[model samples]
Target chain A: MLRVVKPRNARSKRALDAREPKEIEDARIAIFVKGTHTGEVVNNVMKDLMALKRPDAISFSKKNVIHPFDESSPTSGSSSIQSLEFWSAKNDASLFAIGQSTKKRPNGLTFVRMYDGKVLDMVEVGIENFVSMNDIKSAKSTPGHKPLMHFASELFDTHPRFIQLKSMLMSFFNGEEVESICLAGIEHVISVSCAPTPVTLNTASTSADTATSLPKVYIRAYTTKLLSSGTRIPRVELVNMGPSIDLVLRRHRDPDSEMLKQAMRRPKLKKTDVEKGLGKKRKNFEVDEMGDLRGRVHVGKQDLDKLQTRKMKGLKGGAFDGETEEERPTKRIKTS
Target chain B: MDVSSILASHNAKYQLVTVEKETPIEVDAGFLTVTDANSIDEDTFNSNIEEHLQSLARDGVQTLLAKLFSLPTLPSSDGPLAQLPPPTTQLPRSKPLPKIKPLTKWEQFAKAKGIQKKRKDKKVWDEEGQEWVNRWGKDGKNKQVEVQWATEIKLHAAEDHDPRKAARDARKARVVKNEKQRFANTAWAQRAVEAREQRKTEIQRTLAQSRLSTASMGNFDKKLEGEKKLRGIKRKFEPTERSVEQEAKASLALLSRMESDSKKMRKNPTSEKSVLNVRKAVRFASKGEGGVALGRKTAGEKSKKGGKK
Candidate 1:
C-alpha cells in the first residue's frame, strides 16, 4: 500500500547532514583581459595578476587581449557556454579571470573569476592611485628597481570577501579540499585526509621576545551562493566567517624599497655556448673540435711571393715574348 | 470639361458691339474693346461723388470745387451757401490792425512811430528818483565765501616719554652697569673670545702641520686629526636635512627657553614670545600631545612615507 506523504513545514529546521568536504579540482586559471584601455594600463594590470605567482595561473592568451564580455555579441563563438566549455576542456582551465572595462569606470580594472563555467569571485581595482613609471624614475626610485604595481593587501583586510577569494585561489593552488580555515606562517599545517589538525605555532609563541618571528600567513575557505535580497537576480557572494587570525602578511612592497630593488635586479647574462667554445685567440689555419674551419685562412711565404710577382698584363708566346707571328700573304676568295 | 470649353471659359470676355447714338458731335469717341463702361451700373458710377464732395468741403475747398464741379446751387440759408455769391467779411486792410495799446506812454510812442520797440531793458532806471536804483536789491552772492580763523591755542610743551622706550633705555643701562645684565651681555663676548681662540688654535695647528710636512714634528696633531675625523666636524657650518620630529623638538626647546627667561624676569610676554608660543603649540600638536602611543610613531611615519615592504 502507498503511504500518504506529509509536507515538511517551513518552520521546522532540517538537520544538516554530515558529508565529506568537496574535493578541489586542480585547474589552471586562464586570465582573459578585455578592455578599451591602452597597452600600458593593460600590461600593468597583467603584471599585478601575474605577481600572484600561483603555480596554476596562466594567461588565457598573450597580453593586451580585447575579449568581449557581452556574450551576445557576434564572434563571441556560437554560444558563450559552449565556447567556455570547449576552452576549459582544451586548456584544463575551468577557472578564468575575465578582466573588463566600461565607460562608467574608465580607469578601473575588474577581474571576474569563473570556476566551472560559473562566476566565483570578482575584484575591481581602480588605477587612479597608481603612479606612472616615468614619475617614479624622475623621483629617483632605487636603481635596479622598476616601478611596478604592488597591491596593498592591508587595504583589503577589512573587506569581508577578500579572504574567501584568497582561499579559493589557494585551494586551486593546493588541489585539496580545505574543510576549515587552517593556516600558519608560510607553512602547511593541515591536510584534507588527516584528522582534525592540531593548531600549533610554527615559529614561536606570540610574545614580546618572539616579535621578530616571521609573520603569520592566512588560509581561508569559501562557500559561494546566490544571496537573495529582494532583487530579481541574487548577488553571488562568499559567506563571511568572523575574524579568525591577525596575520597581515606584507603582500605589497614599497615601489622604491631595497627589497623591490633586489627583486627587480635582472639575472646576470653569461656568454652563450657557441661564444664559450670559441676561445679568445684568433685561430688561423686551425680546425675546431668539430672539424670545422671556423677561422681566417693562413698564407705561406712562397704563395705570398708568387701572388706578389704575378703579371697583370702581356700575351704569352706572342711577338713580345720572342715568338714571331706568321705572315698572312694572300686574301682568301669566296668559294661557290 | 473638354479642352476647348475650358479655354473658352478662361478667355477674356471681349466682344466689339457698335453703338448707334445721335449726338451733337462730328464723330463718336470709340470705346476700347476692353471697355468696362457698360458692365458698370449707374449707382456704382456715382458711388464716390458724395464722399468726394464731403471730403473737399472738410478741407475748406468746397466753394472752389463747386465752381470746378458745377454742382447744383443751394439757397443761402440751406445746407451750404451757393458758390455764385462769395462770403462778405474781409480781413481788415488797415496797416495797423486794431490791437491793445501799449500800457506805458513810452511803449505807445514807440509803436506810433513804427520803430521796433526796444526790448525792456533788464536794468531799468527809476526816473522819479534822481539816483539809479538796482533792478533787484542785493541779489544773493553767486560764490560762497569760506571764512576761516586761526584759533589754535599755544600751550607749553609737556614732557615726552614712552614706557617701552624708557624700559629699553633702562635695560640698556642695566646691561652696561648691573652685574646680572653684564653677565648676560658678556655671554656673546665670551662666545666670540672662545670662537677666536678656537680659530687661532685651528690656524696654528694647520701651520704646524704644514711646517711638519717638511720634517717629523708634534705627534699630538695626529691625535687631533683622528678626533676630527671621528667627530666628522670638518666645518663650522654644515647643512643637514632635519627630520620632522627633530625640527619639532628644536622649536619646542627654543620656545621653552624663551618662556623660562621671560618668567624669571617677571615680564609680560612680548610679541616675539607670543609668536614663539604659537610655533611651539603647533609643534606640540604635531607631536600628538602624548596621545599617540610610543610604538605607533614609527609605524605611522612609515605609513605616511608609503607603507613598508
Candidate 2:
C-alpha cells in the first residue's frame, strides 16, 4: 500500500525557475548555445543563473548513488511494448523515442533537432517498472512481460555550470564545443498520458510568462524490475537507456596515489641473450706459434722492399715462438 | 464458477510437483513466489506450514477465550498482538508532563542567525549593539576594509645557490683533462715529427753522400763542373703539408688542456688546491706588480716584469 501525499504550497517556489512549457505553442525567447563550457565560463554562467533565481523557488536535495548502473529500457525487444502501452495510459508525457510506426508514431521522436538553451534536456532512469506498475492490475514482473533496454555507455557531461560540476568532456571540448544533454522526454499525449510533475522552482524573480507558459519537469525513465539470475548481463547496459550525468562521472574514476607508488618498477634485460647477440668475436687468444714473425708482420712499404738489406727478421725456425731450431709449428698467427 | 483451469495455470508458477517421465516441469518463479507457493525444498515447506499452523492455533485459543469472557480475545499473533510485549503487565503511570516554553522573537532571531560570541556572556546591551551593527553592515561595501587589512602577509625570498666554485673547478679540470687529450694526439704528432726529421736529414745526407760517392767514382769534378741548376733550384725546403697538419694536432692538444682546466675548475673550484694556489699567485702578482697604492715589501720585482709580459 502506498500513501499519496498532496503536493505542498510551492507558489513561493515556482517564482524561482520555470522552463518553457511543452504544452505551449510559443515561447517568449529561445536562447541557443554553440559549444560546451570551460570551468571559468561555467562558473560565470552558474553565477548568472543563481543571480536570476535568487528571489523565487528552487529545489535542493543531497543523494548518494549506490547502484547507478541498475536501469532498463523497452527497445531491447517487443515483449515490453504492451507495458509501454500501459505506461502511456498513466503517464501522458511523451517518453517514447522510437516505435513500431503506428498512427501514434510515424517518424519517431525528433528530440535532438528541437533542443535550445531555454529548453533543457535531462535523463533519469531507475528500477520499478521492471517489477510492476502499481497502478495497473494485470501487469507483473516476468521475463516475457517487460524486457530490458540497452542504452549506449557513452559520456553524458554537459551544463557543468548549472550543477556546479566539471564533466570528463572538459578534456576534449574547449569552451566553444557544442553541448547537448540526452533529452529523453517524459511527456504527455493528451488521452494516453498524465501531466508531468514540475519541480519546486528555485527562489528567483520570475515573470508571469514563466508561470503561464512554462513547465519545470524532471525528465526520467525507469525499468520494470530487476533481472533474474538466469539472465545474462548485457555487454551493453539494458537498464540505463538515457543520458546520465552522474553515471558519466562515476565512469571517470581515478586510482589513488598509492596505486602510482605500487607502479614504481625497474626494466631488466636477460643475461642469457647477451652472448647470443655477441657471437665468436669474443674468442680467446694464445701466444705466437709460427716459424718467423716477419713473414706475417707488417712494416712500412720501403722497409718491406729493402727487407733483404735491412735484415729485419731472419727465416729462422720457430723465431716467433721462442723455440730453438729444433721445433717447428704450423697454423699460428705468424708465418715463416 | 468452475475456475480451477484458470487457477491451476496461475498456480503453476508457485506450485511444487513431481513431473511425469514423459514431460518437463517448468514453473515461473514470478507467478509462484516462495512466499505463497509450497516450498520446493522440504525444510522450507515444513517451516512455513509450522509457522502458519502456530498462528491459527493461537487464533483458535483466543477465540475460545473471547467467548468465555464476553470480550475480545487478545488479538492473535497474526495482528497487533504479535507486536505487543509479553503479557507481564501494562506500565504504571508516573510523573506529570512538563511544559514546553515558547521562545520570544528576540531569542528565535538570535538562534536562527547562528551568532557565536567570544565567550557566552549574557549581556542584553552588548547583544543589542553587536547584533544591530552587524545586521546593517552586511552589504558588499563594508567587506573591503577588512579584506585589505588581512592581505598584508608577504612571501619570503628564495635562497640563491652560488656556482662560482663550480666555475673555478671547471677551469682547473681543463688543466688535468688537457694532459689526457695531449696523450691522444701524441701518436699522430710523433709520426709527423719523425716523417719531417727523416725528410730533412735525408736531403742533406743524400747530397753529401752523392758528392762523396762521385769523388770515389772519379766523376765529382764532372758533376760539379758547371751545374748552376743544382745550386739555384734544389727543391726548395718548404715545410711539408704533414708539418702543417701536425700544427693542428698541437693546437688541439693545447685547446683540450684549456678545456680540461676549465671543466675541472667549474666542477670544483675550492676542492682544487692547485687552481686555488694559481689564482692566489695571479692575484698576488696583479696586486703587487700592478703597483701598490699602499707601501709594500719588494720581493715583487720579477712579478712586475711577468705582469708586463
Give the number of the best model, judged by DockQ. Answer: 2
Cα lDDT tens digits, model 2, B1-309, are 899998876555322211122222222111110011111232432466323322222222222212222322245434322111111111111111122334444455678998543553332222423532231134322233333334333256234422444444665687678777666556656676789899998997687656556635435456556644333345766365567678888789888988886656467546545435655565576675543422353546657878999
In the order shown, the candidates' DockQ scores are 0.00, 0.01
TM-score of chain B of each: 0.14, 0.15
Q: Residue by residue across B156-222, what tens digits does model 1's lDDT show?
A: 5335644445545765675576666456546756676789899998997786566556444543445
- TM-scores for candidates 1 onward, in order: 0.20, 0.13
> How does each model score on lDDT?
0.35, 0.27
Q: Residue A302 deviation, candidate 1, in Å?
A: 99
- Lowest lDDT sum, 10 consecutive residues, model 2 chain A, at A185-194
lDDT of 2 at B64: 20
Worst 10 residues of 2 chain B by lDDT: B30-39
Interface RMSD of 2: 28.7
For all predictions, the C-alpha RMSD in Å is: 62.9, 38.5
